[model samples]
Target: MKDMLIDDFQYTAQELLIRNKSILDLITKYQDSNSRVNRAIIKAVTQCGCMTISAHKQEIPDDASLDEMKTSVESHIEGLLCENCRDAIERDIGRNVFYLASICNALDLNLYDIILKENDRIRMLGKYNLR
Candidate 1:
């Protein structure tokens, strides 16, 4: 089940995190992992030439509803990731998740529970959840 997988990943990450047990270390490791993920995405755009970021300001008319605004906003991503870039991005993202789990382990928090609560909040708020 997907729930089991989430818990299993959190537990496995907690068990495997040896050096970065301290909260400070865990936070730093998490930030570094995040940076790696950004770097991978940047490489996909800059080095690999697989994607382009055509970002611009989103100007929504006052008459537009939240639903309309959501639909009209662009992600700015121009192309799909190539296989190599996808693999690299996935790996970096996995590392980011690992560090996040490690942070939760250090703080005596449950990553699965956190994710569940977040999902619940999103569903409850729906379009009202601006962030």
Candidate 2:
């Protein structure tokens, strides 16, 4: 159960990845997918008018606790993604994840093992893991 999704995704990517077998191609495709993900979000904001990002400096107090910082910090993104925007973003993100799995496959790495190791590290480090 633990490795089901990650392993399956990695296997599927390896099988379906016909055009981009080269590591260089995989990395560039990964970068392209990342760009598309960003583009989808930008389109959601600028073209669709479904969401807006209001960038500003975070003003968390110096003495604030971790919990306080978590509460005070804001994403500054307003509104929800419309169905069209949501679908586009999801599709782009899926492509990004696929490329990531393909890269792992090329390197003879197990995506599930990587994810599990990262999870273990985060759990072990807990509050101090972020830095």
Candidate 3:
């Protein structure tokens, strides 16, 4: 039963990752564009929560650090998501973290170490997304 539960959680994590990747890809494609359709897509991406018209005027710098971009996008999204959507997104993130922690515990791995390693990898890569 424990194994089955782990498998279920793993599946959920995978599904969430896939969905998140698609959203990130879409965001990447439209984030720097000024096309009307891209603007529409960005608005839709936020589910029309509270994205202000002024938000469309702010442009992400081409030379901004990945962390900067991530922060900007996340802030924008957070501001735009409805209360319920924000809650759901937070819950999903919590679930993913819980699943990862469970797996690390099963393997006797330190979660903090894993986080540091991943942070180093991201720093080396110099590119990351909202997810």
Better of 1 and 2 by TM-score: 1
Q: Model 1 reaches what TM-score against the true structure?
A: 0.96
Per-model TM-score, in order, reads 0.96, 0.95, 0.38
Q: What is the C-alpha lDDT of each candidate?
A: 0.92, 0.94, 0.52
Structural RMSD, model 2: 1.1
Best by lDDT: 2
Per-residue lDDT of candidate 1, residues 39-86 (tens digit): 999999999989999999987878999999998888899999999999
Error of 2 at 131 (Å): 5.6
Rank by lDDT (best first): 2, 1, 3
Cα RMSDs, all models? 0.8, 1.1, 11.4
Give the top-scoring candidate (TM-score): 1
Model 1 poorest 10 in a row by lDDT = 14-23
- Per-residue lDDT for 14-96 in model 3, tens only? 45443223544434423333244344545545466454333344466899887777665523333465565456556555544
lDDT of 2 by residue, 1-131 (tens): 75897788899999999998999999999999999999999999999999999989999999999888888989989999999999999999999999999999999999899988998999999877755
**Candidate 3: lDDT of 35?**
48
Residue 74 alpha-carbon offset, candidate 3, angstroms: 13
Which stretches of candidate 3 lie above 4 Å from their native place?
A: 1-79, 125-131
